[model samples]
Target: VRGTMRHLLVLALAAALLPVASVAAEESDVVVLTSQNFEHDTQASTGATTGDWFVKFYAPWCGHCKKLAPVWDELATELKGVVNVAKVDAEAHSSLRKRFRIRGYPTLIFFSQGKMYKYEEKRSLESLVAFAKGGYKDDTEAVDVPAPPDLIATLKGEFFGLLKTVLHYSKHPEAISQESAYFLAAGIVIGSVLASAFYLFLSLASPAPAKRVSQSKKGD
Candidate 1:
């Protein structure tokens, strides 16, 4: 009789706490998921399920992640029931981290229909919603994503990317064209000048390396 009473008491306690749990869920829009609950929450949203999920992979110590926290709160409030917003702490959950291949902190991914879409747009609420609409597609499809507003930055990035590729393949330094050689020399000169300036400043600020009289050798 006592064992049965104890079981009933446990059930009653769970029932009493249900309302509190529901109210808490109602209060917050974002779901804090760990490695434990990730598969269940995300997988259910696809097969036989009906919700779209937007999840953030973050590390707490990352400054970008810290700045993104409040934005996430706003995203949660705005997305609310329309889309399920969630976060996974990449540092704490190694499995999810590796599974998603999150190379940088504050990586955002949207999951729908057994496919995951990466969000590469600017980290803004509006941008995120736009991505939800059509910024991404399945892995096999070619997504012709437009460049961000800053065209100069985009072109510069492409230029540097091409430069790295060429440099990596060019076995001999002479493989570089004459024009490129001039530019490379200029870059090296500026870098060396800055490094030398820093080194001189540090040398001046540091304590004297050795007493001049040390040459006397303790007595003389």
Candidate 2:
């Protein structure tokens, strides 16, 4: 009886750990993308080709996004070697969020051959896998992916990202670390210069103001 009980305990422990191991395996197949490396990762011109990317832009706290997490993991597993599956935390990566114009809790985009095909169908495992495999081919309305940000746009985006961080630090002084303070000060100066240069360019391009003509009663 003692040996039987020990065997049962081991079985129960194995059962408990199985799901965790499965979830980890599923997650391992999906790439975690961020604002810093997404450009190089997604752009065809940057590095060796790694197939197409099927990216999900999601917010952590969103109920819809949470509901789809398991299905997304399954989708990643299904497309493991066929397509590059990835996810972006849009709430945390403002630059990517702005670049993609992601306004919803969950947005799905498939990048193929430097073009983007939006997934507007159901988010089920089958639908996702099918779309990742070949739905972009049938879709006639593939949108051309926007070119990567230029130097000025990159600087502006970084400055805005830094400004948000500084504002957060202002509300919570305890979170302000030494490195954060140094970056915040430098970012402010650079951001000011970029802002001034942008406004100067706009001012130069704008039409000159019309001059008001004055009549002195015909020199009477």
Candidate 3:
């Protein structure tokens, strides 16, 4: 009876640890690709008999990348059967980084049938899974390239809207003076002028011949 009780106690202890071991094994199943394994794994993914391919380019030192780690892990687990989720450390993979022109950490790239798309914003696990499964539609339209009138018109519309709101709010029982309206108009004008000046400054600063030459040679 003593030996049997000891055996039962050992079995109970093993059973208690079984779940912990299972969780560890599940985590270990997430494929972590480094610079050394990137090419081989990506190639295998391309030739694989099943699933879409998704890769995240990240650097160990980036705070945002660190924050996104658990989200990526959850995405990996949730979409395990539907997608091949992998990660590449950008700092460790100079060639891959250059090839992809990865300007930032935590950039998620999706590939299907040899075509690729870059996810340029933060994404939730559900969204990521839906994207992998081709169930989500990106509703965001491409940004309209700013025309000179577009900015001026937008500023004008915003000023009018603000003026309307201010007038409406001022009609309350504790209404303030109309001077507040003038102040708001002045502020809007000042802000629009400043924004236009800043935009012009950036435009002028961007096309410098020397800067272009420097950038061209930096990669070499």
Best lDDT among the predictions, by candidate number = 2
What pairs collide in candidate 1? none
lDDT ranking, high to low:
2, 1, 3
Could you tell me how far off, in angstroms, the CA of residue 106 lies in candidate 3 after the best superposition? 1.3
Tens-digit lDDT track of model 1 for 1-220: 3344344334333322221111112245678775446666767333617567888987644678878877888888887777888887565444466566789988988877666677777898887776766566633243222212232332233233323323332444433333234333333333233333434444565676585663556655
Which pairs clash in the backbone of model 3?
none
C-alpha lDDT of all candidate models, in order: 0.56, 0.66, 0.53
Error of 3 at 150 (Å): 47
Worst 10 residues of 1 by lDDT: 16-25
lDDT of 2 by residue, 20-45 (tens): 11111222577877665787887733
**Residue-level lDDT tens digits of model 3 in 146-207:** 21223334333333333333334334413322332333334334434433453454456565
**Which sequence of candidate numbers ranks them by TM-score, best first?**
2, 1, 3
lDDT at 170, model 2: 53
TM-score of each: 0.49, 0.59, 0.47
